[model samples]
Target: MTSVPMIDEILAEFLQSGLGIHVGTRNEQLLPAGCRATAIKVEDDGRHVVVFVPKSAAPAVFENLRTNGRIAVSMARPADDRAAQVKGLMMFSWDANPDEEALARAQWAGFLAQLDGIGLPGIATSSWRVFPCRAVRVKVTAVFNQTPGPDAGAALP
Candidate 1:
């Protein structure tokens, strides 16, 4: 695996804010599955990220990652629509720890608050608690800017 540089403070802040987190994976048959991540944890070094997914709501996505490692994750800031997309190989996927679960719940709450602040109809907080969740670690291979404008879709340096 290629060693990518640790994410900078700007991107780290964007991710830690829990604005938007979506994860996608594909099955052996090439069928795609995606689910919103309830929580995102960027390791201090920024070389890795773990996304928590509710087992009940994203069984297919979990299964896909378990069966096939290819994965893509996208995140966007609700305040300004600045966004990024990452494609990577799954490094690990397992039941989330208690701390991870708690963090995810808290982050989900923050995400909802951001939505509400923006005058958007927020999803019920209860919706995030399907329980028996899994946390998947991704080793990023490529990243692209997904924000609108000329720089959109360009590969990140």
Candidate 2:
């Protein structure tokens, strides 16, 4: 099979920079669920993107994915107000492996640092429950530049 990147290098770099990540889903009844993302990875193939959030933190998201499969993830660097969004169908949702957990920890730390750099400090995360995570994998159907600008909402190539 031929392989193509779901996200190019620039977008990938931006996503890896400890931005604020949020994931979205809807149940069969069209009820929306959202939760902070704990970690993210774009596979080497570049077509599969995996996002992590603790199961305890987002049971509704997982349940929604299982039944509805539609998924959308938004990422942003709030200090600069740059943002992007990806929408796709859920490929799978699973318990995070050991390596995935480590990735989550690293990204969460980076996010904390970013918050501090923006002069916001001591943000409480205890309620986030970002551990013993669940990973949701999505096959990218579309990506958009969500940053506010003249070209905001443009579809990324």
Candidate 3:
């Protein structure tokens, strides 16, 4: 099994620190969507992650996430290429709070709209709360080495 850190504690740290995750789809048939976003919001109790994406791409992105239930997310410094990307199966959970959900929808719309002007293909930037499923499974790889890195080689320590 491939693993590189998907524990709740690690995810919580990422969320609290406001990390940037490169959200991509697992849809192999099409080119992956490469959009940047911060872990803007996390559930108060730690059940979900609120990510801000281009409003325009929200529908397709959410739809893809909903249908596929798989995502590759990573956090890296603004200028650093060395980062960790973990594949976590995601699901959309409805927020009982109408205002919050509405805000999410609005953000999604705005993010999606931005993509229209840009000629390049990319995912939309709507903000949605990501309720990741249980039973986390991750795929990990280390560059420049046949052996895994210090962090990549072991289970949650």
Model number with the top lDDT: 2
Task: For residues 1-157, write the lDDT of model 3, one tens digit per residue.
Answer: 5333333565455433533445676454664655454333444433445454444344555566666656655554322223445445565533324555454444434434434444423553333443221112223221111123566523332
**Global lDDT scores for all candidate models:** 0.79, 0.84, 0.43
- Better candidate number, 2 or 3, judged by TM-score: 2
What overall lDDT, based on C-alpha atoms, would model 1 receive against the true structure?
A: 0.79
Error of 2 at 70 (Å): 0.4
Q: What's the lDDT for candidate 2?
A: 0.84
In model 1, what is the error at residue 156, expressed in angstroms?
A: 1.8
TM-score for each prediction? 0.87, 0.91, 0.44
Please identify model 3 stretches exceeding 4 Å from their true place: 1-11, 28-30, 40-48, 79-82, 93-157
- Best candidate per TM-score, number? 2
- Taking every candidate in turn, the Cα RMSD to the unseen true structure, in Å, is 2.5, 1.6, 9.9
Over 1-157, each residue of candidate 2 has an lDDT whose tens digit, in order, gives 7777879887888887777899998998898999888878887776778988777765788888888789999998857879999899888878999988988888888888888888878784555577888888899889999998899889986
lDDT of 1 by residue, 93-123 (tens): 8899898888887887788888887887656
Q: For all candidates, what are the clash counts? A: 0, 0, 18
Badly placed stretches (over 4 Å) of model 2 are: 125-127
CA displacement after TM-score superposition, residue 152 of candidate 3 (Å): 6.7
The residue pairs in collision within model 2 are none
